[model samples]
Target: MATHFHKKPNLYPAHVQLKVSDLARSIEYYTTIIGFKVLQRTGSEAYLTADGQTILVSLIEIQNAQPLQRGFAGLYHLALLLPSRKDLGNIVQHFVNLNIRLGAADHDVSEALYLNDPDGNGIEIYIDRDESEWTWFDDGQVNMVTEQLNFQPILTAADGNWTGLPAETVMGHVHLSVANLDKSEQFYTNVLDYNVVTRYGTQALFVSTGKYHHHFGLNTWNSNNGQAPEENMVGLKSVTIVLKDEHYAEEVKQSLNANGFIVENFAEAPAYGGAQLFSTVDPNGLRILFTLDGE
Candidate 1:
């Protein structure tokens, strides 16, 4: 059988859940700076949407949530992908106007802007380059490099329209800081069946399905052999990976069990209501939700 990357459609990163020390402060930052609309707020938790309908981010307020520790196995960043370069330019201009300190990068597959939320959670706003423009290596890997981003050209492309995140926006990818590369790779690749698109030597690895560059990135730059974040620590709670095909979801459960990984099936839960999905923990103690279209 062909590998997962050669499949018809890839799994989509639906949403991310984060624990924050202050709900009000985090909500303001996400709405004003990141351009997310408040879908709903229930008690100490708030659901944020990019397209005014779907919940893409959730923030749960914890009274004594500890700050994320360096070199810990947890979230590195959650990336938001714009539908077009023009949309990215609009946000870039907004950042410039607000004097937000941003870090920019030109990865061969995408152009990205990086920032941190009020509680120091990492965020990446980016747009993917055309697939035809991507360069592929003989090893079935794509060339992705971090170089200086030319701001002038991107700024010139802006149409000067200031609005919130477009309806087509999506949670592009999630990068994680893991304790062990080999163990994480075994789970994400061997069991989950993602294709390794590329690597940054021994420090990082990128994996994707349907050959669309990357949906997940794992790295040990600052987290090698580190401990998992504490329960009350402010960091990643979980990331939802949505599979479009029901058969694929069943296959994933079988693969997880065969590989000795435990899987919990949630028929209908408030977290992902109306969907038949399963949850599993990676070697580094990160929660991954695998779901089908509907129950």
Candidate 2:
């Protein structure tokens, strides 16, 4: 799989925090079905890893947490990028063996399979086609389309041996349901400095740094003019973006302040281990945590 898109110098999502109603059930689903291993656990929270060390996803068990509702500004899905086509096939066969229902699609740049967790938090597992195969237009928009995925070819690539998530798996990208496309687009592109890579009419847009297809997919399909999910709801809590270093993190914080956004520092938090961490809410109320790489 391509590494440059997610490495230092490109702003990308590295971790996600989700609120779920049942910790054990969600843990079971993530481990057994999604192939994540537990990196840490507390009474009410669990951190998951694809490799043995990095925390890719976290689940916080909310007391009396409500089910995920539609028309809210929250998670659309957090995508997991696999390393190879063979790995994708292995998981597909595993899903078939477990009788899991899925929505599959080919997006020109990648092939993806979608499913939801026990708490209805959406998840996407996908493999990118080679970068050389991608099409770019003169206006700086990368071509992408949703079409039927040919499953037979992917299934045939499986070695019939399914384990867990590969060590190389990374938090590929995140798709969000937001209140307004224009505001969200401006915040992501102008304030956060991501370039617009693609658009689905006026309802949705894709943005990324370093010319990767996209690091974020923003859409108002179900959430146009809607409110954010309540704090006690079972859904996305925050998404963490790993910047290249403290310099970039500071730049982002300054940009947020300049744009009339509130940036809160969490640098002294024990959980963050003295990293220069800061967080701010987007226009639609989605919280985003900004931190440096290797923190």
Candidate 3:
């Protein structure tokens, strides 16, 4: 995997928080199917880790939580980037052995498998091709296309051992179902300083920092002019973006303020090692937390 895309000097999604109806059931699915170990678990919350040190995904159980509502502005999927093609092959074989159905796609830039949790929250497991193979235009847009993934080569690359998620796995990107394409693009680009990397016509667009394929995919495919999901719904709770340092976080906060966006500050948790942290909502009402990388 490319370390620079996820590490400091480029803002990337570090973690994701999801709302589920049942903590126990969700934990089982994440641990068994997704190959994540429980990092910490409280009464109604569980933090999952693949490397045992960094938290990648968190689940919070809400009382009387409703099922994920379609046509709402929320998570389309939270992507987990694997370290290598062989790792991806192993997981594919594992899924095949377990008879778990998946949606596979080759986006020219990466090969991805899609599935949903027990709560219907989407999850994407993918492995990216080398940056050398990527195609970029002079217009600053990266070329990406959804094509049928040939599974034979990936299966051939597999060692047929399915232990669990590799330690190198990281939260790759987030795809969101938003209400308006233009507003979402403006907010992510102007406020968050992301550059548009690719566009799927008027229905969707991809944006990123440091010219990675995409860090976030904003789409209005099913949610055009739709409203945000209710708070108690089984869907995305928030997404965490890891900034390089406190200074960059402060600059983002200032940008949000200058744009008349409401910035909410929450107390720093010990888990973050006292890194500066704050949150703001996007134009689609998706909450985004910004924090400095504790490392």
Candidate 4:
């Protein structure tokens, strides 16, 4: 399958780092239920990958970490984009066999399955509808809606085969529960240079780099006036975006500096092995890291 990583100057979500209370239990859940292969396991961390090499999710062991709170500015859901409708249907059937509860949605542009990890962190597994079928308005924004998902067609797409994540599966997007929509929008657009693709009233905003729908979803629906996660909270640790090269990374760093956003090089960042990092925190306290595509 062809790679889905966007081209140069476009920031694409690469992976997400989540803080979990139990390392062993979370590892089992990801490997068994989510069907991600364990790439590497450090002392207190385990790196998971789909297709055996492309790193996707990182699980850091935080012993005795506080369970994630209800109304905090943190991860709403980390979406895993599957290769095709048949791939999604196969996984859904596997979940059915295991009796795993899930929430389903047809967002017009995509079919999505929602569930939570063992630690209550949200996960969205989805496959996008063909671009030819996506509708766009005159305002240069794509139309997206939440409606009932017709599962019969999805089930019929499956061939009853079971396997791990496909090579084309990627971290399609990350949705965040933020405290303020305005601040989040400004930080993402002005500093990070993402174009505002769509908005929902004043409560939610979707932004993207290459105009393929949203790469990040920001919403204040459940976290209005909410505080950031505490130090010990088991929630989002950081979000990683892949740039094409060091030059592109520096260009983004310069842009962020021009917009008064502090840029730091995190020597201890989690993903991309030890690639150069341009890291900063959003208005709602979500850590965003930009790294090269490891070319």
Among the numbered candidates, top lDDT falls to 2
Candidate 3 lDDT tens digits, 1-295? 6878988878888888999999999999999999999988988899899998888888999998888776799999999999999999999999988899999999988999999999889999999999999999999999898899999999989998878999999999999999999999999999888999999989999999998999999999879999988999989988988888778888999999998889999875534212437889988889888878533
Clash pairs for candidate 1: none
Candidate 1 vs candidate 4: the lDDT winner is 4
What is the Å distance of residue 128 in model 2 from its true position?
0.1
Model 4 ranges with Cα > 4 A deviation:
1-7, 267-274
Stretches of candidate 1 exceeding 4 Å from the true structure = 1-8, 271-276
Error of 1 at 109 (Å): 1.3
> Against the true structure, what is each candidate's TM-score?
0.94, 0.97, 0.97, 0.94
lDDT of predicted model 1: 0.84
Per-residue error for 164 in candidate 2, Å, reads: 0.5
Please give the distance, in angstroms, between residue 145's alpha carbon in candidate 4 and its true position after superposition.
0.6
Q: Once model 2 is optimally superposed onto the true structure by TM-score, how far is the C-alpha of residue 287 displaced, in angstroms? A: 0.6
Enumerate residue pairs that collide in model 3.
none
Mind giving the per-residue lDDT tens digits that candidate 1 earns over 68-108? 88878999999988888888889999999999999999998
- lDDT, candidate 2, at 137: 100
Q: Indicate whether candidate 1 or candidate 3 has the larger TM-score.
A: 3
C-alpha lDDT values of all predictions: 0.84, 0.90, 0.90, 0.85
